[model samples]
Target: MNGPALSIQTLDKVYANGLKALDQVTLEVRRGEIFALLGPNGAGKTTLIGAVCGIVQPSGGRIEVFGHDNIREYRKARSHIGLVPQELTTGMFETVWNTVSFSRGLFGKPANPLYIEQLLKNLALWEKKDTQLRMLSGGMKRRVLIAKALSHEPDLLFLDEPTAGVDVELRKSMWAQVRRLREMGVTVILTTHYIEEAEEMADRIGVINKGRLIVTEDKKTLMHKLGRKELLLDLYKPLEALPPSLAGLGLRIAEGGMRLVFTYDPAQENNGVVSLLDRLREEGVKCKDFNTRESSLEDIFVQLVGDS
Candidate 1:
């Protein structure tokens, strides 16, 4: 309760096909914070989660959940965690209420109909509690998976692409639900294809690629360090090439030469932006308008994963 919600040390996992899915991947999820794990396809995001949940055995490593050794004390470590997997695993014939109620029972938790009722209400599933899983929409089914995951009331929760098929509205609703969970002191580790989701909610971010943990840092710090900002100048007249005076300012002609794009790192001491503006004035280049844009988490993710 006082230490990390989950701690993984030198984690290594190699499949029987001789594919090494994880390479000395080490990470820790802080208590009561939302940590986002970002990666591309076949990047072992799920494999790492599987290893922690005891669904896949690691070739070598040690894991601890709330300071309890994962391997040496698997049950104790597992009981404090909950997983909402990528795929929907709830039974088609089971009613929503029964499915969630049964999940809580699996953890040896006593039946609490009042708590279950509140959970369903919070998720907007109260009306459909008696409906079978097969009758629900894709988004509704996904919500059921979340309901099942939360049924046990674990301190740490892993949501793997939790809103993949959901619409924008429903996705926002789930995001609100996740915030509520964090407010209740649940430490969440989320893997998502939607980089904006991480941008919107994650307190910290971790990037994994090619079976290796590439970087981990506070969300804002990561963005400030790796994210670049661009200043786009809308020229009054089209130019075939950049002015000679602005050659080294990282300026490029775009929009059929109607615009000048100056890419710079705002975090750097000399971002070349000020010099570029001064040179434009000295070189008789006139711009009707100019605007700056900071790279989003998606841009940084693409660059990081691409380079990794």
Candidate 2:
């Protein structure tokens, strides 16, 4: 409440076989914001989450939740944190209501059936409250997991690959629910393989690769700085090869030579759009139509990780 929702300092991890899982990683989650952690597989996303939730021991460094040191004050720190893991490890025969209620009890909270009911409803799981975990479909079970995590009413929630195997509709539903959670003053930190998820939902984004945090910035800043934009020129006639005059420009033939694509950084003062058009006209290249598109988060992710 006084400081960041979660603060991680100089975190490090190494395994028995001498595998370095994390390398002096440090990060902080701003209060009441949706912070998305993006990384390729085995890039320490899960390990970072595990360390903060007291599942995996950090080889070095400190972690605090709402100003409480996680190691020295485990209970107090953990009480403010909730984790929805990627795996479905719920009891197979347990009813949804019972499972969620049991989770609240594990946190030593008083039984609040009204809260549980509303939680179920918020997750669209109220109708399935009486159904056992094994009897529900995959998406419904995922919802149950989220309900269980929020049963304790934590100030901070960590969602690891929340929509990995979910359908498109369910994924959208889950994202909407997360946004509502943020509106309720809950800090949500999520790891996702879907680049669009971070682009759409996150206020800030942190990129990790090879056990280190490569970069962290506001989503808009990352897009404007590192993201590229493309100019797609539709040619009136197909060309067998790039024209000699336009060869110096970073233009590529696409759509079976009927289109010329020029990619440039939007942050730069000169994007070369005018120069490209002038050069094309001078070279007797005719353009039928044209459109432009900004580079997506996926493109930024690939470029960042590739460079690192």
Q: After superposition, which runs of candidate 1 have C-alpha atoms over 4 Å from their true positions?
A: 230-263, 266-272, 275-297
Tens digits of per-residue lDDT for model 1 on 192-231? 7677888788999888998899998899988777678889
For all predicted structures, in order, the TM-scores are: 0.81, 0.82
How well does model 1 score by local distance difference test?
A: 0.88
Which candidate tops lDDT?
2
Clash counts for the predictions, in order: 0, 0
Q: Look at candidate 2 and tell me the lDDT of residue 228.
A: 82
Instruction: Go through the candidates in order and give each one's C-alpha lDDT.
Output: 0.88, 0.91
TM-score of model number 1: 0.81
Error of 1 at 132 (Å): 2.0
